[model samples]
Target: MSLSYENYLALEKYIESFEDKRGSLIIILHKAQEIFGYIPEEVQEFIGECIDLPKEKISEIVNFYSFFSTEPKGKYEIMVCLGVKCKKKGGYAILKDLEQELQIKDGEVTKDGTFRLKSVNCLGACGSAPVVVIGSTLITEADTEKIKKILHEFEK
Candidate 1:
């Protein structure tokens, strides 16, 4: 997607707000992502120029973090926890069910762009094992049937 003039202006304003500009690359990138939805090539290049860092370095940081997305994500991001507690509580089964029902594997966005499926290490809610996070809502003690109902809520 083409970067709008207003977005570039906003990013520039944010960069100029910082005096030191040291140890702010991640923050800048986060702001850029917030502005652009995802850090496209143009945004990356713009950040590189603003921070005087190589695009490769910026790209590396972006790629290393699961929170950062190079591509636009779905409106609803579904994160299934696969940590030990969750796995023991049938997290993998839940993930497989979602993949089958949505016809999209992990790290994939559905064709309708309504949902993005991802498997995370943990959601830090072990007591609520087998949790599935949809956007900011947490589905504790998640099961296949419960997941279907929750997905329908979003589909509507």
Candidate 2:
């Protein structure tokens, strides 16, 4: 679906806020995600027209980056870091536990829309390998027990 009128206008307002600034496109893109939750094809096209950047370039940024999502997300985003370090340290087991606990598979949001779980490339916490980040919180040492604890906290 396309963006609502207020959402489109909010993006336009973000564009105006950065009219005189350099690197406005990136800022606009960020605001778009914040306003719309996820940047879909149509929203990227609208952003392109607003900033004079091509649709391909917009898509490239969103697609290449792990932080951005092309689809909608639940209120709480559960990102399991699957980088080499995280993997070797038992990240998969943690992910498996999470999937079973939440009753959702990879790249799927929970039925109640309370959580969305997805694998991420890296979260730059190699020192604390096997990471699971929930929203803004970085959880180090992602194990089945720890993951269970984490899920319990969110259930409240």
* Shift of residue 109 alpha carbon in model 2, Å: 2.7
Of the candidates shown, which would achieve the greatest TM-score relative to the real structure? 1
Clashing pairs in 2: none
- Prediction 1 TM-score vs. true: 0.69
State the lDDT of candidate 2 residue by residue for 38-75, as single tens digits.
Answer: 89999999888877788999999889877787988888
Give the whole-model CA lDDT for all candidates, comma-separated.
0.89, 0.84
List model 1 lDDT by residue over 1-156, tens digit each: 237899999999999898766488889988988887789777888888887888888999999998898987888999999999999999999999999999999999898878999999989999989899998889999999998998999999
lDDT of model 1 at position 33: 85
